[model samples]
Target chain A: MESTRPKWPWIVASALILVWTIFPILWIVMLSFKRPGEVGNQKGFLPKHWTWDNYRTVFRTDLFTAALVNSIGISMIATFAGVVFATLVAYAIARLEFPGKKLILSFALAIAMFPVVSLVGPLFDLWRDLGLYDTWPGLIIPYISFALPLAIWTLSAFFREIPWEMEQAAQVDGATSWQAFRKVIVPLAAPGVFTAAILTFFFCWNDFVFGISLTSSDRARPVPAALAFFTGASQFEQPTTAICAAAVVVTVPVVVIVLAFQRRIVAGLTSGAVKG
Target chain B: MAAITMKNIVKRYGDGFPAVNDVSLDVRDGEFMILVGPSGCGKSTLLRMIVGLEDITSGEMLIGERIVNRIAPRERNLSMVFQNYALYPHLTVYENIAFPLRLAKRPDEEVRRRVTETAGLLELTEHLDRKPSNLSGGQRQRVAMGRAIVRQADAFLFDEPLSNLDAKLRGQMRTEISRLQRRLGVTTVYVTHDQTEAMTLGDRVAVLRKGVLQQVGSPRELYEQPVNLFVAGFIGSPSMNFLPASVDGTSLSTPLGRFEMPGEQAAAAVGDRGVVLVGVRPEHFEDASLVSEDKRARGSIVQVPVDVTEWLGNELYAYVPYEAPADLAAQLRELSRELDSDQLRTQAVVSLDASSLIAEGTEAALWIDTSRIHLFDPATGENLTRDEDHAARLTRAAEPSRAAQRSTQQPTEP
Candidate 1:
């Protein structure tokens, strides 16, 4: 049945979707290479005079550099913390039976589904009162909390796929419980851990609502939120070209991350852990 | 290396259901003991409890002379091969075999030496650097065995280790495991529902039904003088045929026909009960015409209509259908269900020589060895004619050969 279908239509559809998605990213790249003065001229898709001035300007600004550091530091911390906590929680949820386990899972799903926008106003007020406003901790706390539910869900699914016999065989082979978990369970779950970490990192990196509403300075402002505050060389000028450059720079890590760990994320690492 | 002794061991789950109920077993040093039953019979649970993976609700478990009921699995110093051959996927075969030694903080020199030796033993040397995911099912199974054997733990426990393999591979691995166990001379407790594994691999076998221990004896003893109906029905392929019979002096009337037996044989079989179950193994019945004249005179012959016949090159099996009493039919149905067989109708499977000319839907005369048949009390399922002395003699006769085999192989091991 599948072979009988003409191949051209499917190929055309896929090519159309590919261009639709890549066109915006291509436009951003083109805009980033344009001169700041030419951004508003509405020239052709290619920059009339391609220049490195915008990229140079993006790096020269203290606000952009500091925000870059803040973004990297905050996302890494949140992803590390979220993945560690989720791994333990997911292992318990997958491998153990306890009262309220279903309740906890449902609660996690609820939090994951809760609107981030609704929590912003309340969290902003809470952070100010708690002296956490305009700080890395302020942004990190919310990022980890938001990232945890999804991380736990992904990790637990991976954990459940792992056969319990692997750990039992380890224990019977003269490993303590901790050793069995570290040597057998953890290695089997490495792909899951990497996947959850990348997902959490992406969440923290691309966040704008909390980054914009809760932070007020370069001290904790991430790249997405910091881009909004960029000013040109003069009062009447817009930093459109510089902002595009910063956007392109920010997207590099996300792309590199997905490319580097894509195989690990997609591979089923538990394949030979037990018999089919 | 160690004898594992369980005394009145009981395991009760949270719902207060006993999974292993008051079972006492002794696996002597250098003995291969098999725990076998149909699914949900707690054979695997019993193996888990011995390894300290499951907590015992009551009674004592001893490894060697140490009471290991409170000890964790690792500290108990026993290695187990799981039914699934749980090899660590991320580790190379060499690293997997070296896992236990590494856990014990053994020197790298010794770890390398031991792993190499074990890998050689299981024929896994060429796959040393390859991860489990790259190996075949049989290779992965060998790696799992290598990991277990490299530890040189007190004893080895196998939980249906060959069940995951294909039939031909299972047969080959069965012999491999048997040879390995004999070479090591370790106290091994193996749990499997396959009766062939139980009979072929173990020096003695324990049969369990509904978490209750039925009988523990040498395989020959269990095969020849089963204590009850369940063991008789469970321990063989093409299981024993149960015929509802009523005792009347020296003759017993069965659904097949009335059979007159010698007075001594009848006296041993006839208890206070008037109705009993007569267990006749399929091989005990032969084609009457094919039997030797002297053997034919020693046993009785029964004429019955053959319902079906299967000829498998080497031997022929003839099925004789009969009308059983309603109450006994229900009893047999329940027994068959427990034994993992679905026998919706009452029939006798009679094994005959391949040369026999028996055909389906025809009348045939089958000679039954009357002296070898067992009589069971219908109500309690206990064997009325179980000869305890004879069973003991069978077990006693098996010991010297086992000790001789062990001694001959002792010098080969370090």
Candidate 2:
């Protein structure tokens, strides 16, 4: 009886969403496999002829290779530094009693809500003046600053949900403060820290405005910026397929990270370490 | 085992309000001491101060012979059971019990042996591998007890550990804790707002009100002779009844019948304060028909209309409502507000033998032992009838319980 009706509305709605989201990726992959002569070919969406030339072309360019290395290195460093700083500041905001705790939280929220594009102009001038233009440090500094607000807000909410009595219980059970935090508090907060690291990583990795505004060369330019200046192997060739292949390449790590920690991320977001 | 001493301990928050004000106490070695009071009475604050979980504004605290006023909680060598149990959710029961030993860097074999023995003692042998969330409330409480007992520290502190359990579970754990403390003979301090736990569990009880220590004595001492009106009302179950009374040359006038005060008693009642509060415990009253002639000679009888009667097979409780003047009723209401009691009715409860024929909405003759009456100064709230030497006498009497517990304790593996 329960299965008698055909659920046409949900099926149609799901089909529409699937098409809306996947069509662009399918188009990109199809463009990457198309022959050089089929560039912007109007015969059909599918390629009449397939080739490995696009992937081979992407591998041959030193600009794309160097930008890949820069993206991985810069994003990794920013995520580590941001998560560490956020954990300390979040612990203080959640647990300690000082004079101006509300002000600190308000200031962090303000920074999170600020426009990233508005700051790029001033940052560009400052980086050039400080001899930091087109450098790895130049990109990493702004990434850490922008990503810290997200990490602090997420981690502090998680820290506040922990049962504070456990700390005192640990002390009474004969543990020093440092030992109590390292053994009892850290294990409970691991999921939250991992979630915060993932979020910070995605923020730094997905950034385009700061990458383009702050860097000029392959020495420190991330993939998002380096893709815009791609060149063909010869004067008559177009770089469309090569750019498509590189875009799909840079997206692989994100998909892998999201799939690996998907369960923990969902649990960390829905239920904190606290129980009734 | 070590005795704990606090000399003039005080705690004040930033508002300049004292949570625990100038309190002094000495818990003897291997004794079970209960601190009982209403909420906001600073019983928990005092316990926290002893465990070094809280800072002392200005005082000296000693564990055995060492001055530990500035010591950390872990260095004080104490184990505490929090009200919420505070078990680590990520660990199994065995790991929770073994946490302190691991932190202390005990050998692996020793840790396993101690955790197993402690679990067996708590009757949690089948639950060693389960986490706290899977256990029942009673089982979680036992795991908390196991964690504290496995350490064998200088003392054990309990902050209303039974408060979160159901009534049956609380009753069961109360006895469990009492037996465990007796069997271990560790110097222990427990804090609770429930007076029944104080009466049944403590070798000696300390009663507090509004950050001040009111009385410290044996349960019988606090019951038979409370130090003030606050202690009198705070210690008993149906609480002692307070009624305004005026004293003439020799006789006292109250809602109850006038009674001739003995010469010395009259002098104490009439000292400085012209008016006094008369306190009568519920059990001190009896059915007038059940009293013998000789017993009647030492008591006073009053006929009151019974408002309600509850028969409990062995005993009967008859509540009699009376009229109090405007000022006296207001004062009683103020006292009730300070003590956080639910009702401030002008009623007297009389406990009579079940065989008595007192019924609701009928006038019954009730006889009270006049010699057991306590007189209090209405202004100062001081019990003029208090025995000044009771605290000293209690200390000496506590020695026998200590000796008995020591002899009864089972030997542990050294």
* lDDT string, candidate 2, B198-250, tens digits: 99888889998889998888887888778888999888878888878887766
The superposed Cα distance between candidate 1 and the true structure at residue B278, in angstroms, equals 0.9
TM-score of chain B of 2: 0.95
**Worst window of 10 by summed lDDT in candidate 2 chain B:** B260-269
On the 0 to 100 scale, the lDDT of residue A77 in model 1 is 95
- Cα error, residue B265 of model 2, in Å, equals 3.0
Question: Clash pairs of candidate 2?
Answer: none
| TM-score of predicted structure 1, chain A | 0.94
lDDT scores in order: 0.90, 0.87
In the range A133-206, model 2's lDDT, one tens digit per residue, is 99999999999988898889888998888888888899988888878877887778888889999999999898
Model 1, span A184-247: residue lDDT tens: 8888888888888888999999999999999999899999999999986556777998899999
**Any idea what lDDT model 1 has?**
0.90
